[model samples]
Target: MFHKVVVTLLVVSAAVIYADVYEPVYKPEPLPYYFNYNVYDDYKGANYGQQEKSDGKAVYGSYTVDLPDGRKQRVDYTADHYKGYVAKVSYYGKAQHPKYYGPAVTFFNQYGNGYH
Candidate 1:
């Protein structure tokens, strides 16, 4: 029985090695032949032979202008090419009021900088 088991193991190992080294691989078909299924042949422009485009108007533009006071003014505009475009200006920067003490800072200076 031990001799039979040893013989079986040796046969399996030799068969695995021979199959791995002697297997035959089939070559892949050409690219053009693979697309000859006749399914996409009836599709319109399926082969990408035609170019299509529509005449559409895209009127959208914006520009930012830096003010002399270290602020930026972003102007956005839009219109049709046949008509006209309109733009509005916007300002962004420091506030018109003081930063720290606000309006009370002026009164404090006038009263000798006293908290009372």
Candidate 2:
């Protein structure tokens, strides 16, 4: 039994290593694919490509912005992260935009400095 356990661990470790689990692989299919009610997070983005209501305060956006090629980005400043379509992704260093300026769903994990 002890030997079996060690062998299992080795196999699992090898599988995990071969799978490359420690990288931020960004897949474009989710951004480029069309959105519909049924497809859901079946793609990417926190929500199922649908904007959601947060309690009674924040309004969020569906997927982070997927800017079309050759367009100016307009990133909205969240708690500490900037989000929006690639076209609307604001890349201003140290620049921040109020969450209220954007839809509420984008606040899925909006928090920083002192708040959750």
lDDT of each: 0.54, 0.41
Q: List, residue by residue over 24-45, the lDDT tens digit for candidate 2.
A: 5774432222222423242552
For model 2, the superposed segments whose C-alpha errors exceed 4 Å read 21-26, 30-81, 84-116
- Per-residue lDDT over 41-67 for candidate 1, one digit per residue giving the tens place of the 0 to 100 score: 334422112122222453455555544
TM-scores for all candidates: the values are: 0.30, 0.23
Candidate that scores best on lDDT: 1
Look at candidate 1 and tell me the lDDT of residue 108.
56
Assess candidate 1 and give its lDDT: 0.54
Minimal lDDT window, size 10, model 1:
30-39
- Please give the lDDT score at residue 9 for candidate 1: 100
List runs of model 1 lying over 4 Å from the truth.
1-55, 95-116
List RMSD in Å for every model shown.
25.0, 17.7
